[model samples]
Target: MTAAAPSATMRLIEASTMISQGAEAKIYRARLHPPAASSPSDPSAPDGCVLLKHRFAKQYRHPTLDGALTRARVAGEARALVRCLRAGVRVPGVRMVDAAAGVLGIEWVDGASVRALLGGGAEGEVEVEERDDGEEEEGEEEAHEDGAEVALREYGLTPDQVMEMIGAELAKMHRADVVHGDLTTSNMMLRRPSAAQPAAELVLIDFGLAYISTLPEDKAVDLYVLERAFASTHPQSEPLFAGVLNAYAKGMGKDWTPVSRRLDDVRLRGRKRSMVG
Candidate 1:
């Protein structure tokens, strides 16, 4: 198959609306598939909206090398998402890929980031909509609106339950030998369940730093990062994190022993480094 040239049609980019920008890529809300106005019966066509991640040009690097680097990264991210999907991890599905332009489109998850849902402010904190002055101001909201209390009412789950889901998902991913190099609450989402799915699901996102690895140490480090994230963002959830590990251990089944030991080692090393610094 002939690969699309660097100048290939970038209608996908043209249709996208930039939503947020991070160090590695600019994200946009876009439609991957052209409207099936002619053939609504097309079985291969996917959803209307998609999230596009574009790794823009870097002026510092030489043009040829930069283009190659960008393409490699886009491919890597797409591969990671596919790997998670096969492993039954609730990651957004990839819809389109334009490696030449360093753009990768994925399913647009329609729900709140776990960060915002947990009172961790928001992931990017970009204000998109304006509220009326008559609307309740920020301070007027009850204290229960702070964290998981609202989740209990809306999602019917508490912080502990969400933590368990996070742990189980991480376990499943690690069991599939995919180590998420960056595991943080901000990198997860709570997809609101629909007719297809009955209950809300915890979905891990931003797999830009993910890689395949079978090593227990790598998985342990991943768990360690998740632990620190919980401690920092939802301090009250720290105690319940043991329950998360128990859930993870149950999910891991026979593979839990070694990862558990390695996690202990990682925590010790982390404390030592903190003390030294």
Candidate 2:
């Protein structure tokens, strides 16, 4: 879907910081403080922050079709996120939804994208940790002089652990019947829970291409796509992907057998279904 460039009319009022931009949407970190309800007991929600994803219209597509497509995707993404949240999966909560304007606002999560966390060659200080004073702490590690290989070390996770998180999260998503059509590390994020919490949280984001599916083949294809992504991006990915599947299998329990076999067949035939006569 083609979305138009962001408009001031549609722009989020309190989005003071621009986080990232891609072909389809622009992400902004913003605070959303809605008016208090009639009840005095309803305490004001102070500085309720969120991520505003504005799906800008694409100039490439016809105007009529573009608007319709953009609106649909925005709505779909918001719905998918809500579905995952209700299923006990770790996804940002939907703070607001404006389907007509092609905007899906979600709770702003403080964390690093799985891509940035894994491919850590980024230059400059990174906001890796938060302090008690409400300031983000920068990573003090020196930049890798090797360039490309530097970022790989920033993830703080071994390849095996990364794979396990991927596997377990995907299994939960699939079991809940959510199919993330784009299953890449870039779409996931790793965030440390609040100071009260210890273990890190794996959050699945960007559900623009997500849908609900119960088919074993669909689930298998999701894993296949992720496996290919890891192999292409990271060196020595076999063991890593194996670890992912181990976690997935454990999460899927009895439902994993069929999907595992299907994945093996998919690997042999390649990502596409054969169209031969």
lDDT of 2 by residue, 1-277 (tens): 8987666536564334676788888887666655345424322222356778878788999989999998889888988898898888888899888877778888766666766655432323332343798553443222321332343344445546767887888888999999999987777887754555456677888899998889888899899888887665543334557888899999999999999898898887784444542
Return the top candidate by lDDT: 1
Among all windows of ten consecutive residues in candidate 2, which has the lowest summed lDDT?
139-148
All models: lDDT? Answer: 0.80, 0.73
Q: Which pairs of residues collide in model 2?
A: 2-58, 3-56, 3-57, 3-58, 4-56, 4-57, 120-151, 121-151
Query: Which clashing pairs does model 1 show?
Result: none
RMSD of 2: 10.1
Q: What is the per-residue lDDT of model 1 for residues 165-223, given as tens digits with 9 covering 90 to 100? A: 98899889998999989998889988877667778888899888889999999999999
RMSD of each: 6.8, 10.1
